[model samples]
Target: MSGFNNRNHAVLLPERLARFGPVEPGAKVKVRIPTEHRSLPFDQAIWPEEAAVLRTVSRHLPNVPKVLATRRGFSVQTFAEGTELAAIWGSKPNVKGGVVEGLASLFAALARIPVDELPKPPAGWPAFGDSTGFIHCLIDYTRTRVEAPAHARYGPLFGALGFPADALRRFSDGLPRDGLTPRPFVLLHADLHPRNLIYNEEDGSLHAIDWELAMVGDPVHDLAIHLCRTEYPNRGERQRFISAWHRAVRAANLPAVADYRRDLPWYVGYQRVRSVYTDVIRSVELLGPAPTGEELDARAAAVCRVLARAWAPVGLPGSPSLGGVRAALRDWAAERSEPGPPLADLRARLRRRLAEARTAFSGYFAGAPAPLPPDGPPASASRMRAR
Candidate 1:
């Protein structure tokens, strides 16, 4: 499935749609298909969804991609050439050099967005400045979408690993009894790690290419997730980015944002729990018909690390040791090498949702806004005449 770069498959269409307006036929165009997996429970979006996000954010940020066209299951975005950010940074993500500042600047730019400029956030979007509510919403989402949906298949694994069936709920219970101080919500490029970024060395610009996971939430939460997603090599590197973010967010003057430093750890703790589930589930998926000792050891080691971060926050029964974690993982694998329920039903539901998304897009925004009309000849016609 190719749409918003969360494992989507994008192809260069052979011909531009007539609606794409006049451009040289050779001008690039792309079509995206939302893979069946994209419809799975792990997938979701909030109010002011992707199209509206790109349309508005692109107006203020030049680097964001434009939504050129859309239909039921997928959309087309204006394509550009640049090196993928992952290719530059590779596996160990130092995210150093001017690139570090560039990343911080992107976060700052999002912080400056005037809420008045955006359409009303959906009914449940935590009122502006309700930072506590924002965190609650996230926890709720994990409980409902991430944990609950897959519980039937993964519940035993979670239990075997010492997590209570009510782990998320317990974690939720642990939030400060005194509500967090308010900080205005702002645009969050929730998935802005390297893969979703593209760098153009000729211009020294890093452009955000995916908006599907974009959200409006506490600014600190955004930074926390980014750091967690990227996993800083050392505490110094983490603080360095935080300093950069502080400067950028300060310059943006996003009220109460100055206080982000105090709350970063809590959000990071929250991220730890999220990582616990996602990483554990992924490890199970990696198991083979006959799991090799090395493979199991690697997976167990990874889970051990994440669990060490998450256990206290989640308030599991006892301290989790590496040996204990490895044993639990081995046991879970023995019982069910594969995690997750059957997919045929999920696929059917996904297909229906994609159809619904297409219909809704047509009604609300006329099937996504068409790109600028060709000022002169249609690209195809120009090619035909040349031939």
Candidate 2:
């Protein structure tokens, strides 16, 4: 057929969903649909690439799913039956080590994908797997365009976060200019947040969905992003997941996350800035004049918390003398010299950092937060940082 509706796409079938086994019931297939008109940047070529990624994944995971057919702009692939990990993450049973184990195995599979063999990201995408060099480009673009027009609204808020537009641009443009070169690349799912993770209760397995942004780059970025998500159940669960992940990576003979830990602060800071700009715009549209007072305060605080935690990690150093985010990074490395604190202690520290970040972001607590664009560059790069 020339065209098919989203519902009719064979990939949305119930039986196809069963193949995933342990997943919950009624899970929907999340394939990209082609756009008829120019809408968001994401609509441009996402489906084509998404389709390719799905097929590639199918090749590697032979038992995963199958595409019954394809339409001009749409294709049918097997659905995954399951509950989103985000839904019952804090609940009992699921909270134990089961979910962690499932995810660990799933991530191990993703980490092994050969990056050089995958489809390339859209044009102008910086290599180094999204966050590192790609983020620098995004901030540079934002500084040149978004920040100026929206200055009056965001100037104060940006100042409070210690991320004025000029400063961001300077940091981006001045990044070890040579850092732009691409190194060994690995296929990255980019987005592995709770919503995208499906846990099959029946078989006690996990399936990672959403591959629209897959690309090749450093594996540590992927682990860092996953680690950040696992950080949700407070720090205790986060540590267990990290320990599990460390063991898995080591056992699998995969690259470790130590390098990512070193550079994570910069990527985190980059995302924080991007979030402020994006959220500002979203708040403005969702609520006229943009969220202000307590709402604004809360939102700003959340953003700042992320910034503050990442600040020390990126600015301080391993040894004396080096300063800025780089120096902070060294300090963070030095702190891990111990055998690693108890999970509870790490959770407390993480919560404290989050609280501090919120305070820093909410300096404009009495007024409207900055107003910027609701969306930025394709999340492919930033999302990669998340992975």
Candidate 3:
């Protein structure tokens, strides 16, 4: 299988399970190479810690992929044998009945794991068993890891565009924390969207992959992140899924499930605000150097849309107009000139050809207006499926 690069380095390879010198002779294995991008500092240390988490959690959760082998930077696991739920559902799965129940059951099982049984978190993690402090710590991490660094790098441009450097801090301070119910934390697979889930049609079972972002945090925050990343097509489906999760966790006697309804909106707002920093960095990174006018316009539009969605959640005075965003990007692009590799060079060539053709077709139509960005912002979470 071909490999691709995103926030992490990953490759999909099919090898006989026997190669690992263990059970399941002819079964295939999936090789995962998790890399840390310094620019995206939201995750804790990866590799060994995440590998340990996977091995520990798989013992209790049968759906988790079994770790076959591990070393620095890479690991191999028994390949999950099923279709990705996202592929089956085509982006937004309908969550009307059994689908919701299945997901809820998965969440309940995850919450039921005794916190003491899990491996100790990497050093400097807030002392274990302090759920409320952990939640507050997460907010602090978003400020230090994400917002601070992002502001230092892009402050002048963003400030010129009307988003002052103090925006994220103000937003964090204003989030209503008084009404939050103090709920016990649980081991959470913090990134659980359709893409990370594999569904076995034969038995109707769902398996979760990609435990890199797993953490011991507020259970309600986990559900909030899941719902926001999953992008349910409508509010009705979102509520149905939440209700199913509520019932499933309650039936399992997990007390934290009780606070989900009252607390979810705050976490949702946090996710939205966190996304602005990451997405802005991503937009600027994608701009490389010497971008064409059209490329700059497209990227600026993308960043502007993200800023617009985040403005309400962060209480920004105003968002930059598309023209202002474009100008800012142009100025920033002029200051950086990092050359990409040969493959990137080839892709750039192809992109230019496609853009030229698109321009010609537009001219033939008397220059009809270009289509606007989508109705809403893109998902703030990583959508890459585990291979």
Candidate 4:
């Protein structure tokens, strides 16, 4: 209720939990309306199956929200009562020991869910319990669902970034496959960032909401994603949490715990590379129809940071220089512009038409646009020229 607001006759809730509640004296119900589009393809494919999964899992896990009713694109659940864990611990350098223990217990319980009891995975899911194969499948999804679709949508803008169509495939191929032994899969709360966790201070219980991304996979992969997304205060805290996790899973007799050290790095790397595609696409989309020179520079800098970290893991080329990025973006904007009524607009229209004619035969790939020319002016200089 804290983040909910009424707008246009709809109550906005967090994440994909859409619309609910006009607070009467004692309303205790919440509604979740699935969104039309999911940012990731896996979520898109598996979301329709979540209501059933949640219903099944709730019978086993008390902290999971109880589904009171469900229909296509919408469901009603009992409103979870507690403070969001993010509000309490997200900015803190460290959390109390009990909090860590609670989280560990929660994950262990989820892992104990009988895999046979859960619904079948959506189509194209890899064989059950094949952790390495599952990751390979994700790499392919990154290419087909994330990169290819993004390229098709923002062809001209992305083309200027100098990545070839098979960039993701190349990146996936670069990953080491030597120690990827198969392990028994278990139910996993795939997205386990702080925001998705609810902590009841009085009882010291942690409730996990948001089953939209849940699946059965290698339990260690779940742990890896949790650690990456949660952003522990420091390496020591992360290690402590990992130890707690190992104890919990080992107690539950989950076999995946044994290979945690060997497999974690690979899963973490995959998470980082997966983020690259989404972040780059989101950054470009944020540029809107018209962006200031400063905005372009900032966007480029943000993207470069992600690319720099991901470069080794994904086998990417060096990030373009800030100047190069600015020029490339500027050129893309200019090419995308159409004729307007003013004289300045006429020049833009002329440039766009000429560009089209030059690359017309290439369909969309006529002249290979290089990164901003080396001699191009800096962002400040470009802004001055614009003025």
Give per-residue CA lDDT, model 1, range 87-160, as digits (tens).
Answer: 67644254456778999899989988876776666687788789989888888888887877556668777776
Would you give me the overall lDDT of model 4? 0.63
The TM-scores of all predictions, comma-separated, are: 0.80, 0.59, 0.77, 0.74
Cα lDDT of model 3 by residue, 1-387, tens digit: 211221211223323335554445545555553322425685543234667788778877888877765544445566677887777654435432556688888888888888777777666676544555665677777888777887777777677566657666676677666645667777889888877788887778888988877888678877877876776767888888888889888877567776667678778777777777766776776566678998898878777877787788777675559998888888887874443233344344433433443353332222211221333222222232221
Query: Which of the two, 2 or 3, has more TM-score?
Result: 3
lDDT over C-alpha atoms for residue 367 of model 1 = 41
Predicted candidate 4 versus true structure: per-residue lDDT over 1-387, tens digit per residue: 211110011122332222332233233545453322223452324545567888789889888876644544445565667887877885544445788998888888877889889888868787887777888876776777777876776676666765556666776776665646677788888888777788887788888887877888788878877986776778898999999999998888668586778878878787766766666755653355567978888877766665665666766666556566566666765665542233344334434433433343232222422222334322211211000
The most accurate candidate by lDDT is 1
Model 2 score (lDDT)? 0.48
| RMSD (Å) of each candidate, 1 decimal | 9.4, 16.0, 11.4, 13.6
Clashes in model 3: which pairs?
Answer: none
lDDT of every predicted structure (CA atoms): 0.67, 0.48, 0.65, 0.63
- The candidates, ranked best first by TM-score, are 1, 3, 4, 2
Winner by TM-score between candidate 3 and candidate 1: 1
Model 4 TM-score is 0.74
